[model samples]
Target chain A: MSNLAGWGHYPIVATECLPERGPVDIAGLVSAHPSMIARGHGRAYGDAAIGQPFTLPTLGLNRLRSFDAATGLLRVEAGVSIAEVLATFVPRGYFLAVVPGTKFVTVGGAIAADVHGKNHHRDGGFADSVEAFRLVTPGAETVTCSRTVNKELFAATTGGMGLTGVIVEATLRLRAIETGWLKQQTHIAADLDAAIAALEATAASTYSVAWIDCLARGNALGRSLIYAAEHASAQEFELLSNGRTAFPPARSARLAPPLVAPSWLLNRASVGAFNALYFGRGVARAGAPELVHWDTYFFPLDAIGHWNRIYGRRGFVQHQCVIPLETARGVLAEILDRVARRGSVSFLAVLKQLGPSHGLMSFPMRGYTLAMDFPMTDTLLPFLDEIDALVADAGGRLYLAKDARQSRATFEAGYPGLAAFRELRCHTGADRHFASHLSARLGI
Target chain B: MSDQKTVLILGGSSDIGYATALRYAEGGWRVWLAARDLASAQRNADDVTARSGQPVTVHALDVLQSEKFVDFVAQMPALPDTVISVIGELGDQKRAETDSSYAAMIMRTNFEAPSQLLDIFAGRFQARGTGTIVGVSSVAGDRGRGSNYFYGAAKAGFSQYLSGLRNRMSLAGKVRVVTVKPGFVRTRMTAHLKLPASLTVTPDRVASDIYGAAEENGREVIYVAKRFWLVMTIICLLPEPLFKRLKL
Candidate 1:
């Protein structure tokens, strides 16, 4: 037995973690353990990937089964990470149709969370790019799920929090690109309303995201820097690379912080000062349309390895929710105000626009999503409850991938499809075999 | 096709074996991965081929079955340019001291089986007049201690065999033998132990060191982290009276 935690490092649990090096015998494992949950890279920021007694880590099952160059379709084992895919195919002029903020996450985790990216408004969630997947069911039978085969399972498994089964392999559609570069345009928004307007205006771009200053108050409340980008063509890349048209070479991380930061080091004042400098730098370079590598444009935080250590040993919780478009602007402003009033320091805050959801329990919808990270501290859990009530009233739903604590009532209120999902689980006998901390907490 | 190099890894399912296969594949060599578990070897072979865009084949070879060694060599598609044996078992020392069967299994896994397999490859290489052989040994072989002398003794015997092979191959002036002594590698075999972080290195580090040694001629023996050489030198030269008195 060993202690394990999600990426947030909060709610650490002591469990028997089975690391497999070959094709997993899911049926055997399920029959042997009282209860278990399948985990991939443990990238989910909360309890969604942890179990009470058993956690099956699929990092060892990584392998690429096949690839079709003519059709740009690739089949890979669930343990294959987005970073691995990028490393192998980027120079070959292909990219994943959807990629989350970090490339460190595995394909299985992305499918389980139905992760969305900066291109969500244009490309939809990860389910849009997935064509099929092989799942080892609770009954120990391997079944292929897709639009035409095991259709119901396909709908429920994506974004089902790994309750449906253990995903083993997936076939994904890859987007062809001329070069691994993006032409990015930055827009500086002085306040909450301006930020929303900028995101709405650039809805046509292939990718768009905003970095907000959560501590800024009054007239500067919700001040943000919005980045809109499109894939750079070969000619555009050549113009920037001294007539060279080759893809960007992979580079190692520049910095890896210590294992843990001192508890007293990340208070409100220190975080506020860092935000001020970051916002100022963004404002200074707001106008020019620059050609930047994909790594710099999409995964800026990845450059600092183990960045979660900045939140200290107690770890942190990320509060991410999406409100309907009709009430997004008002709800966003209220959320920013409530956070500022509480004087809780959130070091990183992100805002993005999403298109319609693809899976039964997918997080994305036609609305605006806001994500903020708060270091674990006394008086923070109750404060988050207040925010949860506000979101429920606005008919908004919290992202399970980022949730560590939330009332069962709040979860049911947001997901109207919960009853259908539960019914399927009961029919498949998944309710008795597959489980996680998040599943138990939400009474799924 | 003639210009492409080929390598055969004997324990391809092991962490160090898989990593070395990937390193050689990245260097544009066709890799043959052999393991007792055919399923695991195939998976690793597919992964190496996918990641490096190089061809990889899988074969089954159970080192414990000494009688099958001849047939296993004959079945290979061709004699590879290099053959690396990374097969060993770190059996429980306490159990081995009391159980003769367990102690004998450890001895055969670490010393006898590997030596027999390498002897076959060495004979073929000698006849071919040009080949490289790498044997992965452990730093524990430098000295025996009360904590794990069973595994250490087997490894020490294996290291001696490799040194003798190197001496014999040098006279031929065609075949090369390299011995690798890894101090503390963070692999599944050592996952249960709480090793000091400063002394432990990743399997990838050992894989690259092996690749570098095979590519450069006349590089006979090396330590994975290089620092282990100095550390082992002191341990090997220590006075036996004082060494036996201190607990490792």
Candidate 2:
């Protein structure tokens, strides 16, 4: 037995972690344990990947089954992380169609969360690039799911929070890239409305995301640096690489922060100062279009290993919610105001526009999503509950992958697809065998 | 045929073997993964191939079956530039202490089988006039401990065999032999043991040490994480009476 927690390190649970090796007999394991959840890299920010009793760590199952260079399709075991994929295929001119902020997350976790990238507004969620996946059902039968085969199960499993079954393998359709470089154009926004407008205006770009200053107040409230990027052409890469077109040198060495930061290190005052300096830098470099490495553009935080430790031993909770386009501007402003008023410290704040998602329980919709992390404290949950009420009133939903604490009522209010999802789980007996802290907390 | 360097890894299904295969593959070597479990070896081979964009061939060779050693070497596509033997059995010390059959199995697996297999490869490489051989031993082999002396004794024999092999290969000055002593590796084999954070190193760390040894000539022995060399030195120099008093 080992103590485990999601990426956020909040709500750590003691569970028997069975680190699976090679090919796993899913049926045998399922029958052996009363209940278990599949945990892949534990990159989900909250309790989605953790549960009581047993946690089947899929790290050992990592293997690339096959790759079709001609079609740019790769089949790999669920534990295969995006970092591994990038390391393997980027040099071959292939890249994942959709990638989350961190490349350390496993393909299984990506599908389970129905993760979206900065390109979500243009390319949709990770499910969009998924061709098919092999799921080990709660009944222990391995079933292949695709849009056409096991269609309903496929819909429910993607973004289903791993409750539908254990995703053992997946076939993903990768995009061909000329070079692993992005022509990024940064636009500095003065306030909430301007930031939203900038993101909306850059909708044509293949990728767009904004880093907001959560501590900014009054006229500068929601001030952000919006980055809009498109894959750099071969010619552009040649100019940068002295006529040699190659993927940016394999991921640079990452610096690991101390195991845990003191709780008071990241207080509101410190975060406010950091945000001010960052916003100033963004303003200075605003409008300059530079060819940056994919890692720099998409996964900046990944450069700092164990970055979560900066949040302190108390850990942190990420409140990520998406509001419909119509009410996004107002809700975003109100959220920024509430967070600022509370004087809570959030070191990282990101906002991205999302296109319509297909998965039954997918978090993305045709809306604007704001994600901010707050240090977990006695008052944090109750404070977030109030934010949830506000979001619920505006027909907004919180992302299950990032949710550590939220009232079941608020969850039900946001996800209307819950009824269909629960019905399928009931029919498949997944609800009984496959359960997680997130599922039980949300009463799904 | 391309002049790509080739490496054959015995016990390819083991975590250290698989990691070494990947490390060699990534360094532009065509990897051959041979193990008793062909299915598991093939799966790992596929992963290495995919990751390195190099073709990895898988073969079945049960180390305990000494009769098949000659056939296993002959069956390979070509003589490899390097051969890494990562085969070892960490049999339960308590069980082996009483059961002669179990104790003999541990002894044969950790020492006799691997040494015999390498001896065959050494003869082949001698004829070809170029090759590198790596044997993965352990820090436990430096000195016997009551807790796991049965398994440790076998590894100690294996380590001595590697030392003797290195001396023989040095006479020819064409072939190189490396013995790797990894301390507290965080592998499935040691998952049950509560290893110290400072001492425990990942299989990848051990793999890199093997790679370094193979690439550099005259590197007869290496301790993974490097600090294990100093650690084992002190442990070996300890006064027996005092060393025996403390439970390791």
What tens-digit string does per-residue lDDT give for candidate 2 at B1-248? 88989999999988899899999988999899989988888888888877777889889999889999999999998899999999978889889888999999998999989999999999999889999999998889999998888778889999999999989988986998999988889887887789889888999998988998888545778888677789889989999998998777
lDDT of 1 at A333: 95
**Per-residue accuracy of model 1 over A1-444 as CA lDDT, tens digit each:** 888888898878777887564456665776676577888878789899987577988886577877777888888999889998998889888989999989999999899999999999999999889999999888888899999999999999999988888888999999999999998999999999999999999899999999999998899999999999988998877776665446886556899886798878887899989998998888888898888788888888889999999889999999999998999998999999999988888978999999888688888889999999999998889999999988999999999999999999999999888999999999998898789989998999
What TM-score goes with each of the models? 0.93, 0.95
Q: Report the alpha-carbon TM-score of model 1 versus the true structure.
A: 0.93
Residue B88 in model 2: lDDT: 79
**Shift of residue A215 alpha carbon in model 2, Å:** 2.8
Point to the candidate with the largest DockQ.
2
For residue B69, give model 1's deviation from the true position in Å. Answer: 2.5
lDDT of each: 0.88, 0.88
Angstrom error of the Cα, residue A261, model 2: value is 2.8
> What level of docking quality does candidate 1 show?
medium
